[model samples]
Target: MDEVVRRDVEHAHGDTRMISALAAPRRTSAGPAVLLLHDAFGLSDDMLRIAHDLARLGFPVLAADVWGDRTLPTTQEEIGPLIGSMVSNRSRWTARLDAALAAAADQPEVDPEQVVALGYCFGGSSALELLRTGGRLRGAVSIHGGLDLLEPDADWSAADPEAHVLVCTGADDPMATAEHRAALESGLRRAGVDWEIDLYSDTRHAFTSPHAKNSPTPDAVAYHPRSAARSWAATTRFLTELFPTVRPVEH
Candidate 1:
């Protein structure tokens, strides 16, 4: 994995400037691209490790960063303020996501027409928001991400009808409440998107992250080996369906 600079993304609500993730594919690709978004912890080591896993599966992956060059948040207590501010100011993340996709498409290793976005934890929510904001993806996969509406009452008519969506959720996640799931379901259904969901039983938030237990509430963020394995399989399956040419190397 190497740090290749992605173009500066435009973001600002009350003076926040453009931020770069210093992120790129863990390895240069000879196939399609996946734009990977990080969680509230920012582009931490765990997130980069996950990006590497995806890269090994035969895709050039661009790790997306919303917070511009700021110190990475450690504990949930430290993360709360940064994530809270970004969520409350939805424009910040939406713009950041857009720029990440644009940057991914521009990379020489990427097939501009074959780009998809994948997110983990907070990134999962951003992936969905990219759809809500009309991001033109071949497909999207959200692994244990929040389901709340980023912009309640926002129009969905502009969303890309060609993009299919896969949502992998921990059924018991407090962060992904019933209300948020309902809103996501209704919005996606109303938008006429082709989508699927893997509701992992007894799972909680950040099921794919070993570092999830580092959060203040361990149980709420505990990792589930079963769900993690299954969700990753689901993600690869979804990607295959969208791009039959997507050749995933043996794990």
Candidate 2:
């Protein structure tokens, strides 16, 4: 079995301070490094469990907590407010993401060149920001995350086109309305970025969260076991293709 450990890493070059990262190390000599961004709920035990599972699949995963040590908001109202605030405050949050990626890539067991980023909800939405300047990331995967920014008219035409992107969003999410989805596809197409968007019907916001009864929006329901499992498999396949050193496990 692989080793799972928690790390508190500090960003050396930026204004962003220290953040918590849960690292799961594989048994092999080397593997790809992935920075996992948690949703608005912060770093829950479920996040760490996902990290461990990914590690077992041959990648060393780092699930970073961007909100320092803040507890999860108790209600949907508070959750909405927190998401609003975080999206408006991108510079600060992006810095933390940058730090997490830098730290994850620098680890001894990781292959920096093949680093990737994956996020859920706010974290997933934030992962798109990497595309703005995600040169270091070989690819990025966003699950049930909104692709829009705080500013409706913020231009992002200069993003790198070579980086791969996989986005899974709920079709019923008002936050990810039809217009928003069209805009994202348009932006990516205009930028010539290689990407794919998977829309799941009957799914809502935070579709990956195991506990989300009062999702306010109909799309904010409990996790879809099939969707979550399929997305994870697809992400793992993407990483394997990017970093060929990670061979599939033999049953």
Candidate 3:
């Protein structure tokens, strides 16, 4: 695969503290855009790699940062509190996400009308939240992320008619339990949204992160290459179906 272009950018919400990364296929003209939301770990090399992968598939991508300048938590013990802090300030988090989506759509290389929001872990929930806001998005994809609905009675009446959703998860992931899945399904169904959830067997949380294997709690969160590849394949197909103008690169 060819190298994609990448650059750092700052997105100003009410606080102007978040920094984002933009990546896309080299030498390509304007194309569909993807607002890539990072996991609870915040922006990292793994997330950037995912952006590049999407760019190579003919979609411009922007990796949004939700954690501002806060240092990323390296250990499991620290991750809980860091995530809790963001969860406590859900309004601010949602604002930052909205800003990131706006910034991505405003990019010159992006076709704003054909934008999608794709996220992992905590970001997965953020993607769903974006949908709940009735943003002008073509679709949303959640990869092994939390499935809790922020608004049970959210009004999806203003959502884009073409809006689609895909949730990929590990069946054994304790964080994303059966209860969460059931609740998410009920909400989507009530909203009359088009959605699908693919559960991978024998996979745990963070299956898409190559560095998950190095985590202290490997049993709870480890990389599953097979699951990752399958989920990514599903994403590409979903994107292609949603935006027929952008064809995915054949591997």
- State which candidate has the highest TM-score: 3
TM-score for all models, in order of appearance = 0.84, 0.84, 0.89
Per residue, candidate 3 scores C-alpha lDDT tens digits across 103-215 of: 88877878888889999988898888787767778888999987653444555565564689999999988778888787777777767789999999999898988668786
By TM-score, rank the candidates, best first: 3, 2, 1
Per-model lDDT: 0.74, 0.70, 0.81
- Clashing residue pairs in candidate 3 (N, C-alpha, C atoms within 3 angstroms): none
Sorted on lDDT, best first, the list reads 3, 1, 2
Tens-digit per-residue lDDT, 94-179, candidate 2 = 66677777778777767777777888887887777766654477778888776555244545565667778888887777667778
Candidate 2 lDDT score relative to the true structure: 0.70
Model 1 per-residue lDDT tens digits across residues 1-251 = 23332333344323544343333433445457788888777777777776666666667777766665645787768888877876887776677778778867766667878878888888898888887888878777898887653555666776788778899988898878777777777777888888888889999998888776555676687888999999989988887777676554443
> Backbone collision count in every prediction?
0, 1, 0
**Displacement of the residue 8 alpha carbon in candidate 1, Å:** 12
Candidate 3 ranges with C-alpha deviation above 4 Å:
1-3, 27-29, 148-161, 248-251
Model 2, stretches more than 4 Å misplaced?
Answer: 1-17, 27-30, 77-81, 148-152, 213-219, 248-251
Better-scoring candidate (TM-score), 1 or 2: 2
Task: Tell me the spans in candidate 1 whose CA falls farther than 4 Å from its real position.
Answer: 1-30, 149-154, 214-216, 248-251
Report the lDDT of model 2 for residue 89: 72
State how far residue 212 of model 2 sits from its true place (Å): 1.7
